[model samples]
Target: MSLSVWVPIVGLLTLGALFALFSVGIAPIVGPKRFNRAKLEAYECGIEPSPQPVGGGRFPIKFYLTAMLFIIFDIEIIFLFPWAVHFDALGLFGFVEMVLFIGMVSIAYAYEWRRGGLDWD
Candidate 1:
């Protein structure tokens, strides 16, 4: 609403936009343009690239499952951090809620463990 409040927000946003534009614009000139078989190949963690079908080949279902589990746990940790910071304000009700939340997470974890979600082999 006010100049003092709006100016800083707009200024920061403009700065961010300028930085992004500069990086994307200058990168082609400053960065390498060399393209060979190795450079064109998709990165596969430090492993040698293997020849595959036209569309980069099929991904294993296990990779999807593992990624979903990682995202779930990552979100769970995010909630925990905010709850911990406001622990005092939440008091007994928050404590009970957190316990229930933790219980649900534990159940899901146990189910995954029982179903071999944690197994690599």
Candidate 2:
């Protein structure tokens, strides 16, 4: 491989780095400095902040369960994209393996559904 081929890639990387640095460096000076009680407080998806327990209270298990479900499905998609793109090359073996993988994922989905893990209320 010739070092000349890497010139554009290195140039693009340096340009990206400079752009990110410039945006962050200029933000404080350009952005509003106004701070109020509401602005300073931690915000949650437009819901009013609840009072904290005198001692830090335990978080609801549902919150963790929902987060876990998101991660599980998100990882499933990551695997699926590569398999789909290579479908022609992988042929029958890949098809069977993906079917089995999807079957397992479906079982987990069904189990969560039965357990009310998907419910918001």
Candidate 3:
């Protein structure tokens, strides 16, 4: 390729690096430095600062199951987008590939359903 193409590519990469560096650099300088006992306490995995509720309020498994389903479907949609955009050019081969992909997802969905993973109660 010509210097013209390489120059712009290099300039863009340099600009992107500078932008990211400046963003991170400015945050520490401008952001608050306040810290307390609550802030220092580990949130998720560490010991709970508060007492547990009555019945030890259990978290429903359905929440995680639904989130997993959303992630799987979201990924399926992402892959389908490019295939959809080039459907005309890809023709039968792309169509078959997409069908297979959908079939696999469907099988997974069926398995989840059969295993009671989709149940709410």
TM per candidate comes to 0.73, 0.79, 0.60
Give the backbone clash total of model 3: 0
Error of 1 at 15 (Å): 0.9
Candidate 1 shows a clash count of 0
lDDT of 3 by residue, 1-121 (tens): 5688799889999999999999999999899999898899757433364567423776555656677788778989899999989999998999998999999989878876776777765
Could you say which candidate leads in lDDT?
2
Q: Candidate 2 on 41-79: residue-level lDDT in tens?
A: 987543457787423665666766777788769978998
Model 1 scores worst on lDDT over the 10 consecutive residues at 46-55
lDDT of each: 0.81, 0.84, 0.80
TM-score of 2: 0.79
Higher-scoring candidate on lDDT, 1 or 3 = 1
Better candidate by TM-score, 2 or 3:
2
Q: Residues 1-121, candidate 1: write the lDDT tens digits.
A: 5689888889999999999999999999999888898777888644466676434676655666677678769878988999999999999999999999889888877876776678886
Which candidate achieves the best TM-score against the true structure? 2
Q: Model 2: how far is 52 from its true place, Å?
A: 4.9
lDDT-based ranking: 2, 1, 3
Candidate 2, residue 88: the lDDT equals 100
- Greater-TM-score candidate between 1 and 2: 2
